[model samples]
Structures are given as structure tokens and as C-alpha cells.
Target: MSQIVTLQAFLDHWAGSDPEKAAIASTVRTIAGTGVGIADLVARGPLEEGLARIHGSDPNGGGDTQKELDVIAEEAICAALREAPVAYLASEESEDLIALNPKGQLVVAVDPLDGSSNIDTNVSVGTIYSILPFTEADRDNPNAAVMKPGTNQLAAGFLAYGPATILVSSLGNGTQVFVYDRESSEFIMARDQVEIPVETREYGVNQSNMRHWDEAMSGWIKDCLAGKEGPRGKDFNMRWVGSMVADAFRIFTRGGVYVYSSDKRKGYENGRLRLIYEAFPIAMLTEQAGGGATDGKTRILDITPHHIHQRIPLVFGSKGEVEKIASYY
Candidate 1:
């Protein structure tokens, strides 16, 4: 086996080997910096005396209630990226894109504290991010740059803060994972070239929204519910953590299908997850791990963004299962 190395050393080696790709190096540094900050916040836990408690209102109007940690994490991530070569920072908590350095070559979108609702219950939550290149034309118009398709992403990743703070990322290469070593105060490489299984008997979906689902989506779940006696020909386990990061981490470690599809509800025509910050980054990671991500009708990465906070239906996981879901569309 090859020797394990720290995340900094690994990133430095890549940066050194590709000296001309300054954006790549900068992205690496920025992600590492943000990951550290997020991990530190996770370790500290909720600060009841301060602003760590659940906020009374969500300033962004994303529909989800914002927690104090969400604002704190966003501030920390933005602070770290401010010094990096990032031209713009788009976040879930913010109502608009914030410009950092106009001359910078990259734009970053982030979900500062995903699944923040779980914070009160001590359930796992995380941070998700995507890095994209920006052109000279994009300097004055951050929205134009941020609205690019997920296929334009240069890099993407997520930090799952559970029993262990884990960082999984892809730099247009295969997905890799690192675990935070608290004693050494560094992220140590845990697994390199991680790939999801092609098939599995596990699945995740918000069954509570079954009544609102469209025919295609409802039919798929019906079959899964039928289990061995149905056409699927096997028993399948159902799981729902009400946390995308936690669900994604579980799929990464094992093999399972996760779906957050569009239902017939009034505001859910396009789904609930943000296309840029949530769906795009997770789709990139899924593809990197040999899995697949889609909206049942088209590849997730192929969908173009109309706005920063545009929502989309997300169905991703084991390649075979994802394909199966696509067939139903």
C-alpha cells in the first residue's frame, strides 16, 4: 500500500506538478481552508448563549429555517475564500452573489451548513461547495458566471460533519476522501479513488412526500415498496435521514439510490434542492465516484441554471439504479 499523506501535502504535490494551473492550486487551498473552518465549527457544537441557536427568520427566503451555525459557517467560508483567487462567492444563506476579488479567475458556490435543521436533534449536517471558472465578461456579471451548467464545474466537494468530520472532493478527477485528524490538526487522506457500487438493494427517498409525487415517481416507489413480490425481484431497504449530506455520505460509503424528486406540490415543480450549490456539487461528486446523477429526464450536470437559487429534482447513486430511475421518466 502507498503511504498515507496529509491533505495539504497531497494538494501541494498536485499544485507543484501543475504550476501553470494557478486556479487549481488556489481552489485546493481555498477548499482546505474552508474545510478546516467548518470542522472547527462542528467541533465546537451549538453555542446556546450566542448566535448559534436557530434563527427566528430566514433572511434568504429559501423557505428553510436558518440556524445560527448556518450564518457562522457562511461567514467563516467567505472569510477564507476572500484571500483565495475567487472572484465571486454564492451561498445558500445570502440573497445575492457577493464579489470577493474582481480579478480572480474562479467563482465558488456553497451550501454553508446543509441540513442545518438536524443541528437541534444532533443529527449529521455538512458543507457543500462547487468551484467554476469565470471569464472577463463574467467580472461585472456574477450571475452569468454562476448560472453555468454543472458540467462547467472545475471542482466540487462536501464536508460531512458526523461522528467524524470527513471531506470528499474531486478536482475533475476521481473522488477522494479525507478524515480530520484532530490530534495533528490536519486532514489525513482516508481513501483515494473511491467508487460507488454499480448495483445495490438500498434506496433513500422522502416517503412523506409520496402523496405529492407525480405518476412516474410514485410508480417507482410503489415498485420498491412491493419488494420481492413485485417486478423488482428483490427486497430493498428504505432510508431517509432528512439530510442530503448524510444521505450522500452513506451512498458514498456503501451503495444506494437517493432521490429528491419533483412532486405535484405547488412550489415543488422543479424540486427543493438548489441547482447550483446543492445539486451541482453533489452531482459532480456522484459522477466522479462512478455513480450517476440526473433529474429522471436528463443528466444533472447537463442542466443549465437560470438563477443562483434555482431548484431541481435530484436522483443519484449506483449507476444501475440511477439508470433505472431515468427509464421511468
Candidate 2:
């Protein structure tokens, strides 16, 4: 098999294959640039002190509180993409889509800083992004392009700024992981063509929201909690890190499931995870990793996005576990 040493090397291998591959390479190159800056900011300690010193409390359209680093990360990503072939940009930090380059050929949707709520606690957070083709009609109405379904995404990925900065991505090829080499200032391939186990005995969910869940979801959780006494007659374990990127990384490393479903709570009927950025990109990566991603009743990639900031329920991870949850729905 061909050895894939670095992210640029991997992209170059693909770029040699086709024009579409070349475009993807260029876009991901820009994302990597932003990732470097984000890693640096994350590595520096005492984010809370900087948060208090740099900015006041400000919330995004989704009503999630944004920290100072969130804004800084968003700016860095936007700056990197400005010179890329990105025509329309949709971000979690922005209320609406922003047209960056009229003549560009790609549309990007991003969650500049996911899990920012954990920043103060010194927990892991990351950036998520989805890249779609920029069409002629999109030039006429950019929001239309920005609202394209996850199925339309040509590439999707996330940068996890944890103990070691990692970039997990898929370009309709397969899920791959790259770890940042601080000494080299490059992202080196750590895992290639990664796959999630078909079955798992572990699951991750926010148990605090149990009271607000509907019957189907509640029933599923009950079954999981029952362990050996449950319907499956096997023991199970639960995990929740309150950070999607961190949770996702664990699922990728080991076979498991992660659920963030809709509930009876206000503003949560359609779920809280953003479709274009958060759910879509993760869905793409999960599917590419031989896992599954759904909204309890439907495949996440198959859902037609109606708005740029549309939110949806997300249940993803090991194929069997995800399928089992969908069965309950």
C-alpha cells in the first residue's frame, strides 16, 4: 500500500487523480492553515482569564454563549478561506450567510468553535466544516447553495484541539486522521481509511435530558441502561464528554454510539445540532468511517436542508448501535 505521511502528501496524491481532487486539496489546505492558528490558541493556557479580558458575553444565533476565543477562531478561519475558492460562507457565529468571492467555485459551512461552553472549564473544543460546490444558481441566491443537503457536500472535516491537535476528515473517499507535529508545523497522517466497528457495547448521551425526550428515545435509553437485564441480555457502558469533537473522537477510536436527539424542550423539537456544519460534517465523517449517522428516523446525509442554520437531531457511531436506535424511532 502507498504510505501517506503528511496531510499535504495525501492531498497531493489525490490532486494527481482529478480536477475535483485538486479543488478539495486547495480548500483543505486553507482549513489546515486555520487549524494551525487554532491549535496555537488552544495550547496557550488560561483561556478563561483571556476570555474575561478580551470580550463580554455574546451569544450566537443558536443562543450558545460565545467565548472570546470563539470569535478569534472564526476570524482566523474566515481569513484563511478568503483567498480560497469559497463563494459562500455560512458560520455558526454569523446569523446569515456571507458571500466571500463572487467568482469562487466552492461553498463552505463551518462551526468555527464547537463545544465552546467547555472552554472555561479547560475542556476540549474544535472546529467543524463542510465544503460544497458553488453553482450558477448559488451565485443568484447564495443562501440556496448554503442550504444544500449534507449529501451535496464534497468534503467535510473537523479539527480537534485537544492534548494533541488532530484533523479528522473525509472527501467521499474514506475517513482519515492527521495529528499535528508542532516541531514540523505540519499535520501528519496518523490513521488512514479508518473504520468504525460494526458493533459496540458502549454509548454516549446527555442523560440529563431524559425527562424531555419522547417515548421512543426514552425507551431506547431505558433499554441501554438495563444492561444484562435489558432486552439484549448484555452489559453496556455509557459515556458523555459534553463536547461533540471529543465524544466523536472516542467513538472513532473505539466502537460506540453518540446520541443528541430532539426532545420536548422548547427550541429542541428539530434538535440543537446545526445541520450544515455540526451534524452534516460529522455525518459525512461517520459514514465514511463505516459508521452511521441519522436523525432517529432518517439518515442525516439524506435530509434536505431548508435553512442555513437549520438544526437536527444527531445519532451516530457504530452501525449496529445507530441502527438499533433508529429501530426504536
Candidate 3:
């Protein structure tokens, strides 16, 4: 018989004296009847399944990019969570927050596939999520209640489907890292109370959109370019992996700033990051790790998701750099 582990049990074990604390934990229980690994099966596995349906061949039939793989992966991840005990589910793949367990206490926001454009290149891609408490006393209308910001999240985490599929997350106390035990098909605690050094001067930003950036953004990049010769006397290293989850993971582990700003492009008026799923989850995780997240000017957690798949500019990381970006805005 396959070993069974319940998410609820995991949560209870993780939750200490603060029993009222509502949070989410990554559990790798086998799917009933299928015996397929839950933790091991991220967007890639689902992407393979979806691609099989579309191509009638294996995922290796042709070289696939992250964007293409993401489309397939999003569908699979959403489908997997259909029966999860969540109140409302939001994702970068959907146009709105999906109602799952209406009476459930938590709302889940997910990015089924992030940095998918990097997949063809074998770059690190992953999934991000935020969990918020949905109390009945909040409101009767589902839309109004779920419009809360990322700041309201009770827990947040990410799954890095890389050379080693790992899950990193926190429920307010501190950050925790877990490894996907393929044999046991469960997430075993790998690291606890993980910390990110604040003094690191690394920064992440997409330079391709430099031409479309606003004056403030342009000015900020110029300053960073000046490095030790500029307003900030410290040297700065720039990193842009083209994947929000991957970039955010970098910031989460090592201190750095990441920006996805609103450009002059017509379609990119707001920004590229999805507010509910991608940005919200990363914002929560960042804050929990003693970092900051913002929309250049306003704090990311304070901004509610106006729309289900609302896209917004994101600037987060070391407090100093993030604040500098906000100052420009």
C-alpha cells in the first residue's frame, strides 16, 4: 500500500501553540488510485500530459519553450487543485478567481508555470502560490472578499521544478525548505528558518524593455549601471532570468531587487506580473523572508487584486533597493 499523508495533518504538525494560525503546507501524498507523486508532479508533468494530447507525441517530440510549456502546465495544475480544500483559487492562467470549496477557510493563488519561456533553454522555472484566510465574517459576496491584497496572505510558497524539484515556503514564523522525496513521494523538511542576507547588492531586471520604460525606471537603471561610481557607492550586479518565480527564488535565497515595470507599450500598461497569483505569492514570501515587494510606488501586499488575473508592475527585494525604486516612482 502507498503511504498516505494529508495536507491537513502536515499543517497541524507545522502549526505549534498558535493553533488558530491558518496556513498552507506542501504535502506530497499520492493521488488516490493513481499512486502518482503529487510533489514530484509539477507543471512539467502536466505539461507533458497536455502536450501529449495536443501533439499526440511525447514532450520531447520537439523543443518547447517556457511559454508553450506553461500553457499546458497551467491547465494541469488547475485541474489537480480542483478538489483541494480551498475557498477560491486564482492563477496566472485564468481570467478570474475560481471558487473551489466555498466554505473553505483559505484562498489559494497560483502561478502554474513561471519562467516558461526559459524552459526550452533548460532554465529554472517553477510555481508560486499565496494562501489567505477566507473567514465567513469577511463578507457575503465572494468577489469583494477575495479582492484582498497579498499582504493578507496567511502563507506563501513556491515549487522549483529544476534539476531538483524543491518546495520552499513559510507560514509567518519563518521560511522552510523541502525536498521532493520521489521514493516516498512526499516533501520532507530539508531546511528550516532559512534566512536571506540583506547586504547583497545583486539586482534583477529585464533590460530588453529599456526603451519602453518610463523616465523614472530609465533613471533608476542608469544609476545602477553607474555602480560604485553612481549615487550608491556600492557595486551592483544585474540578473534577469526572464522568470518571475526563478528571479523571486533568487531574491528569496539571496538578497536582491527584481523589477517588472510598466512600460510604454500599449498592451503592457499595468505590467507583466499577475497580481493575484504570481506577484501576490512572491510578495508574501518576500516579506516573510524580511524583504519587501511593491509596484514601484505602492506596496504590493496593500494593493488588492482588482481583477482575477490583474497584471501589475513588481519591484521587490532588499529593503534599500526596493525603497530606492519606489522613491523614483
Candidate 4:
């Protein structure tokens, strides 16, 4: 835990030791660098007029009601990547693959704002990003570059802009956490490799959707609620923040399981999370930090994306707890 250094220093080390990863190091830097600006915008909140006003549904056909900050965050990352060595930019905010540097060797998938629905409420919202090596198998089809499996990711991370602006990432090496220092306007490494407790007594899920969940899902909650009075012999805490990043940060800081499962609801059979950007990056982070992520039954990183904006169920947290939930199914 004593491994303290500025993000730039870490990046320098990352690139200096391996020239082949220069593109990845630079891309991570670009994402985190622009993330600072996004943090400021989020901090401003109501100060920024119409920041949370509904901008209409996502033009990408994801059916998400877009907010002004959502577009702003997406554009900020897009503009920044134009200067980085990025071949293509795929986002949940956009349907088409954005061609950046044709010569760039990497493709970046992003969720501009993970919890934009909570923007107007002044709750925590963050950005998620996944970096993949560019594939030239289908030069004419730009979407092909983004259809790879999560295992193909060179790097994945998310910026949780809560009370503290922390940038969490993994370079396939391990998960690293960086805290933003306003004094220097830079991110400094705050934690080295982190490990989640194998077991936890706390859990998170949107209880409002309890009726939509199937028996396995509802039964699990019921057992936990039963505490020592029912099948489960211990008390458990239930938490729901209505934001993925916020819930994830809690699990990372402490320990817990968060499930956003595929329910019986119409059009939500595959779950609501976009696989490429949201699930992939979070899965990578969780795994890197000695946790696990799954779609109730399957490993998230093992799924090959069929489309750039594909949605899937998401469940991740303490490995033991995750396994327990999977056993229920």
C-alpha cells in the first residue's frame, strides 16, 4: 500500500519498460486527463445550466435518455482521443464507430457517464472505458474492431467522481487506484493492487425491480432478508445507490456484491448494461482486484460481443459471494 507515485510517473514506467505498450499507456493517460475536466463539470452540477436536462434518447439507439453532461462527457473524451493514438472510438452514447487516427493501434470503448440518470439528483456518476488492440481483419467494416471479447482488452478502467475523484484501472498487470490532487491538478497513485474480501455480509441491488426478478433472484434476497430467522443464519445489509459507480466504489472500498440481473421484463432479457463498455471494464477491474464478475452464469470477460452496443446482465464483487449467488441459479 506504500506504493505512492504520480500517475505520470507510473505511465512513464509503464511505457519505458515496454515500448509495445506505449499506445496503451498514452490512451489511459488521455482518458484520465480528460476525466479531470469531466470531474469539474460534475462538481459544478447546477452551476452549469441545463447540465442534467434530458437531451432526448441516445441517438445510438441504446434508448437511454441522454443528459447534457452525458453528451459533454462523451465529446470531451472523443476530442481528447483525437490527439491520442486511437484507431476507433466506440461508445454507448453513439451507434457508429468513430474513426480517429487511422494509424492508431488501439480502439477505445467508453460509457461517457455511467449514472447520468442520477445527474440531476447530485449523486455520483462516473465514466467507464475499455481499451482494445485494433484489428484489421475487416478494414472496410469499422465495427469489426469493437466486436472482440473482453479478454482482448489491453486496459480497462473507470473514473468514479464521488466525494473524491478516483481513477481505477488495470493494465492486465493488476488494478491500480489514483486519486486526483487538485493542488497539482493531477492524479496520484493512492493504492496498489487491491483485493476484495472473499465473503461479505452486505449486498446491493435495485429492490424496486424485485417483482421483475425471477425466483432465484428473489429467493436469494429473501434468504438474506430472513437473516438468522430463516435459511440464512446471519444478518445482511442491503444497499442501493442507483448508480453503478457509486455502488462499485463501496464494494471496492469495503466488500459486497452488486447484481443487475436479466429480469422477466420486456426488452430487458439480456439485462440493461452495455457489454463492451460498462460490463467489460467493470469485469476487468473486479477480476484484477481479486474479485469476480459474471452474468449470473457466465463470465463477463469470456463473452464475445455480437455488436458494439450489446447489453448484458452484470454481477460482480467478492469472489465467494459471487459464487454463492451463481450457485442459486
Candidate 5:
């Protein structure tokens, strides 16, 4: 049988009363409590009356349609953090930053229900979150405080709602994964200090956009397609889940690279994923797991966000694979 280590037990053991560590543990627990509830609604799916994807564009002006569950999940997360040590809550579903407790000392950036496009399809999706210490100096200037560089994140995590709910996170230490054990109604620590393999034969990208790819990207694709005859001298497998967290979960499980880069298509120049909520947190988690994350040119954690919803290109996973792709740029 798998060793049963509960989330609370893990946090209690790791935090052990350090103020910052305790705060981080508390904040993570708060969000996870709601995640458990969100998972229940997700499992109900179509059977739940009036539970449907909200058609049309998102209220945040994003092209994607907001789903019913997305709103519920966002509200639940917001409510959960209202008393936590979180001063500001920035969400993908919200147009502006939410002011929580004035005395709180941290900021939370989240995509409440990411990959909403797959909501109706019953495919994998998740909630991505980043926790950063609120800069007291810039407290009055929410923009400045919220736009801190990804390197400043104190903790980051994501709840992948799929075949089995997995809560993966890091508290500036190492990444760990917790599996939801329904029998005990707890998230059990299944893996600690997860390290991604240094090499991988698989890669994930959207092949439908091949025509819009830049020369460097096109060339890289050509080499991979060439298989044994290619410069890589080995065959490659391609996988695309059309969902960031789903793809990331696969990369964490084995070892693979997932890229959503700036193509020539309009509005895609900067890529699709939001930097603060999606890319930045994922980058932190990937690195904590002994992998790498970059934007073809610059490291993800090194990029400073200029706005709450800034988008960016992302290439992440195994170190060598990430570096090899960056060379093309």
C-alpha cells in the first residue's frame, strides 16, 4: 500500500511554526480546501442542472468563453482566501485585482478554472496559482506590487482535476504532488521533491499552427519530424492536450517539453498563457522539480510582469530539451 501522508500532516511537519512558512502553509491549505469542493462539482458534470459553459466571450475580455463552474470555482477560491494572509487576489476571471485583508502580507495570482474550453468535453483542466510576498513599500500601488518578477514568488501550486485530483506545489523549496484519497477525504502526499528526468523523447505543441510558425520554430519542427535522419538522430513523439495543466502534469509524470511560443499569427505574437497566473507559476513548479522554463530567449522567472494579465510565450520541461529549443531562436 502507498504510504498515507496527509496534506495537513505534511504542512505541519514542514512549516513547524516559522512565520513565513506557516503563512504559506496556511494560504496553500485555504485554497486547497476549496479545491476539494470544486472537484465535487466537476465530478457531477452534466448531471448537475443548469451547470453549463457560459457561452460568448469571457467578462475579462478574453476570447475564451467562461464556464459556469469557472465562476463558482473562482468565487470559492476568493472566499477561502479572504481570511488568509493574502492582501490581493488576482484572478483570470476578474478584470481587476481584488483587495482582501489590508493587514495580509501576501498576494495570490490565479487562473480559477484554466482550460475552460475543455469543460464540456470532460477533459483535464485545473486551477493555477502563485503566491508572492506583498511589498509593503508598494502596498499603495497595487500595480507595482502585483507586477513583481516571477522570481519573487514565495510559493506556487496548481490543482489538476482529472482522472485523480493531484495537487502539485512548491514553497520555494522543492515541488511535491499530493493525490486526493476519497476514502479518507484527504490529499495524501504521493511524491516528494519530484525531479523530472533530464532527457525525454517526447514533445508537445499545436501542430495545426505549423503554417504560422516562424523560421526557427519551423526548422525545429522539421528536425523532429525527420526522426533518425534528422539532426537529433532519434525519433520523437508529439502530444498536445490543448490544456496547460494537463500537459504539465504529463511532463511532471515522465519527462517532456511543452511549448506555446510566439507565432506569426495576429494576437499570438506574445503567446496565449498569462504570465502571472499560468506561465510564471508553472515555471516555478517545473524548476523546483529540477527542470527548466524559458521563453525561448529569457527565463520565465526572470521576466517582470508589467500588468496583472500580461501574456507570454512559454517553453518548459527537461533542461536540455528546453535549451535545445531555445537555440533555434
Candidate 6:
């Protein structure tokens, strides 16, 4: 009998295949512009250089080191998939949808660099990606290129580059976590079948933004508060780390809900989280782990991405609270 390596195996292999390959790719000459595919992006230079740059010690005299990290991540992604054969590429950094290998099987959406604000503090940051197959007609509508939701993703994953760069991915069946073995230049399986325990207690929300919340959100929080002190008769804890990836990673490891929603704040029409980059990937991960993700009204995956960096409200985690929050909406 032949061994059947899980889909996660392939992803892990890729993660370790090229240690220095550019993680992101672009062709826009300026710091901000439009480009295509993964090959044209520039390399991020050395790992130590990236580490130093990430620490705000870069001598480039350019923009913030986070931007440089973003570019590096973008380049790394491009280099990693230069031959992986993906079709359209939608990213948080680019305004235009990039056409790469038009006949390829996969359409990839990425947040090349997540949690850039945490770089200064040496906190954990990550890369989120979602993969969908190219539909027959999707090839024509540039905007409709990657139309599937996170629920329909063939592969969903994130690479956490912090104290140690780790890869977390799903291959439809289950989740896997791989740690970078720098010496061997390979990803070693540190965990498998990463199931998020479904306990119902704590919840995460940014109370500082409470003034901008909608009736539904505020109403739900009121209920949670009531449970904590008033009537519902349960003690509740609140957490808001400001970084979606960090907040979500904690939820995945622990058990809880995280919310960032549409509020009355100016410029918050669609919400703060990016649909293609942040919400979808996390939503997919949450769902795959027996958790739930919603936009208060609809499933996160059901909301098709209209733009590369389109923002949307997000609420996800333990089934109970997430459902309860959605019920309020």
C-alpha cells in the first residue's frame, strides 16, 4: 500500500521548500500601484535582515519597516508560488486583481502581512490565504475571479512569523500545524488534527469602540454583560488584543469569540476587517475547527469579496456566543 500524505503535508512541504523565497509578489513600481502574478515582486533580502528590519532597525530610510515587511511577505508569497500554478491573485496590498497562469487551478487571496502594528513590539504576526478553484466564467470577470467564500475554500492557511515562523493550514479534512526547522529547512509536524475546543464562557470585543457599535452589537454585549452581573447568571471575561490574528490565534487555542463590527464611527461603513484577506481565512479556520464565523447577519464565507481590500465586520468563535451574537442581529 502506498502512503497517502494529507493535503497539509503538501502545504507544509511548500512552507519549508524554499526558506528564502519571496513570500509576496507584485509588479507595481511604486510603493503603491498595480501589478500582476508572483514572479515580478522583489525579494525581502536575508532572514536576519528581515528580522532586523521587522525590529525597526532598517537602514533603507524608506517607509516604516512594516511596509518593508509587507513587501517582503508579498515577495515571499510570489516566490513560493511562482510555479504552484494559481490563477487570479487578490491581495490586501494591491488595488488591482493580478492574473497569473490564467489556466491554473487555484485562485488565491492573501493578506501578505498581517498585524503590522505589532512589529514594533515583537508580537506575533501572520499571513492569511484562501484558495478557490477557478470557475468556467470566473476567468472573464476580472472582479469575479475569486468568487467563492471561505466555506468553499479548497485550502485555507496562515503562517505566523514571530518567535518562530509556523504554518497552520487546512486540507478540507482536518487542520495541521507545522514548525519551521531552520536547520533542515523543512517543516516538522508539531500538531495534527487541530480541533478548537467548544467551551462557552469568555468573549472578545473592543469596548473602546463601543460608541460606534450598532444596536444589535450593543444589544448583544449588554446580554453578555447581563450574564456576567445582571440576570443571565454567568461570569464572562473580555479580551481585545487589537490584532485580529493574535486574538483569533488565542481563540483557536483557547475557547472564545472575537468581534469587530460595523459601527457608527466615521469611515467604518463596511467595518474594519478586510473580507478577502482577514475575515474569510479566519472564518474558514474557525468553521473547520467546529467554530462559527458571521458578519452579524450572514455567514462570512457567503459574503463574496467585491474588492481586494474590501472591509467587513467579523464575529467568530465558540458556537454558542457566536450564534447568540448573530441572533441579536
Q: Each prediction's TM-score against the native? A: 0.95, 0.95, 0.80, 0.97, 0.96, 0.78
| Candidate 6: regions farther than 4 A off | 1-66, 226-228
List the lowest-lDDT window of 10 residues for candidate 2: 51-60
lDDT of 1 by residue, 207-270 (tens): 9999999899999889988999998989999988998999999999998999999988877987
Candidate 5 segments exceeding 4 Å error: 1-3, 55-58
Name the runs in model 4 displaced over 4 angstroms.
Answer: 1-3
- Per-model clash counts, in order, read 0, 0, 3, 0, 0, 13
Error of 5 at 280 (Å): 0.6
Let me know the TM-score candidate 2 reaches against the reference structure. Answer: 0.95
Using lDDT as the measure, which candidate wins?
A: 4
Off by over 4 Å in 3: 1-10, 16-72, 137-140
- Candidate 6, residues 39-67, lDDT tens digits: the string is 12222223334432443432222132445
| Model 4: lDDT of residue 315 | 93
Q: TM-score of the candidate numbered 1? A: 0.95
Candidate 1 local lDDT, residue 60? 70
- The C-alpha lDDT values of all candidates are 0.86, 0.87, 0.67, 0.89, 0.88, 0.66
Question: Which lDDT value does model 3 have at 72?
Answer: 55
- What digit string (tens of lDDT, one per residue) describes model 2 on residues 1-329? 36639989889987896876787789998997788888777777584257424354434556566678878988888888888888878898887777787678888899988887777676788999999998887677888876766789999999998999989989899999999888998889998988999999999999999999999999998987888988978888999999999999999888799999999988899899988889999999999999999999999998898877788999999999999999997
Return the lDDT, model 2, position 154: 93
Position 194, candidate 1: lDDT: 82
- Candidate 6 overall Cα lDDT vs. reference? 0.66
